[model samples]
Target: MNKLYQSYLGSFTGLRKEIWLLSLITLINRAGTMVIPFLSLYLTKSLDFSLEQVGWILSFFGLGSVTGSWIGGWLTDKIGHYRTMAISLIGSSLFFVLLQVPDTFWTICLGIYLVMCVADMFRPAVFVAISAYSKPQNRTRSVTLIRLAINLGFSAGPAVGGLIIAHIGYGGLFWVDGITCLIAGLLLLKLLHPKKSVEEVEAPITSSQSAFSDRSYLLFIFTMILFGFIFVQYFSTMPLFYAEVHQLDEFHIGLLMGLNGLIIFLFEMPLIKYLENTKLSALMNVILGFLLCGISFLLLNLTGWIGILIVGMLFLTIGEMIAFPFSNTFALSRSDGKKKGSYMALYSIAFSISHIFGHNSGMHLIGNFGFAFTWYIMLGLAIIGILLLLILRKKLEKETIEISR
Candidate 1:
């Protein structure tokens, strides 16, 4: 029952028009984001790509995302989120339509790859906009609300994608994706106002300068890459494991994701609410969450037990809710208004880069070592992340002492 978080429900009795508009933008973007869960399926069914081929192609998508994050941050510094998002939506929508065009495999691959790059560019703008609009007091609540919008889309997207694939076929799904972007672009255009001056901004990771660079931030980014690597499994590897090994249908696959979104929606606010303001305790919560998810990953071979698979996703969501927000808050708190977009953009790039490495590696591990061993890889990664976090804590403390002057 924090007042700002209460607004996430649109249940604060009176919501600010600005917040309402921001929420609508969230809903619009998320409704379309549902397309990502179906990207591999599209490649397999419509483009006739092998699993490894799909992974390679999706790696391009990850590259596009990494590039886009930087571009978005720069745009926020130069233009504004409103213009950046508008362009991204329209550009992505056009590419979404282009990807649907019947073409040879490489043609489709390159086209979609570029499409992802252009489409991806809008996110930093959106994140910067959110941060700019928020007062420091309610920043976490705003981030949480944005995440809730994403999960709401996640919950609905796969179920809808399943139905679309079942009926209209894959092309229809892309068409819908295109349309969703168009709608989201228009909505954002209608609702968002451009920030004229830069004083309102808060994070600055976008610059190539050494000022934002620190040993602690480096450790944090490395740990995040590992966290993101484990997560990439959900999209590229997990569904295949379930299907080839456990023989699950699309419905069950969709259900697992839906359950994840459900858990985050109902539980994330409460969980964060319970945490105290002690930085160490919050960091520990995040560490525990990632470690738990890493361990639960091994249970994935139990795809035979759909219930167990679902439970694993449940654990993963718990870890994500605990870790990601704190991570965002930590990074943003360390940033200034002029470079906020850049910092977020860089953070987004780290996450994107890991997907490129993670899935390609996951495919290899699963093929050679099997499910159990593949998860062991995740376990090792998680442990490395935790160790780095501990190192970062010590480094930061020492830095603080030195800077106290």
Candidate 2:
């Protein structure tokens, strides 16, 4: 009993100062992002844009992200995390407010697209900062804190946005998001400045794809692409599955998202603590997350009840808990030297590619295959991912041992 109690306490108690700072960083950054949930709604309802135009605008967002991350990673290698992040935050905020400016279709698309890219730049810079801040020993803990902060921000955003929109209007959401970004950017610069300064100035972060000849890094990136493809269904496909096939309402849909965040917030610490020592094992966790995600679609088809959605969400959330921190830790471990910035950028590249494939494939699958068939197809994808990941088990174990040395 004492052991159990100690274990529980130990999970949250031993976090490093860096983890705390990163958590606050994420919370503040996400706090500023009231634009996410209401983005599509605002475009359609308030801006008088059609669904087709909204889709085009959203694609620009992704395109901007791809460009932003790629460029940001390069800049991080040349400059450093603190400066890169500060620039990204300040620059992105300017772009966010540009969304509210009335203009031609292409003009609005270009503006919003740039804002997305600025946001994307923050992704690798944030991860690379964590890698630089903590040694390999506690990298997973650092990442878990960031992930938790993002979810916390998500849970907080809707409630706040809903109330704010009630008073300020939808256009106000973009302006507020911009203001928060500016504030958060200043905070991040303050938070990430290294305490013990070496006399020699540090070189910036970098990521040359040709240099990624480190097979482990490449493999990890590839696997993440697959996992991301499967994981993205939560935001995209899951809602349609719930509403169209199961005949559920918006209330249940919102509740399911809330429950997923709550579950992750409550349990992510314990889960990451348990898995902190098991880096290579994260491959299996990611595979399992995909399987759960796959089966979640299947369950929705099988069980018509709203409770089934909760169950499916629980499975996906658990999978996320297991997979992400480990994957993050592994990615950073490879690029631990002077080239860490570039290395982290390579990791971001996988996610960008995965976003394109996942969103396109999800729509295609659900459209033609029908709901249940899509789930079955996703199940097959997960199983194949597991098999592919097993091939890397030996290499990952060796990597972990080397990091310890």
Give one digit per residue, the lDDT tens place, for model 1 in 294-331: 86786665455667887788778888888887777776
Q: Which lDDT tens digits does candidate 2 get at residues 340-371?
A: 66777878877766655665566667667776
Of the candidates shown, which would achieve the greatest lDDT relative to the real structure? 1
Candidate 1 Cα misplacement greater than 4 A, ranges: 1-17, 195-212, 276-282, 301-304
lDDT of 2 at 254: 48
lDDT of each: 0.73, 0.71
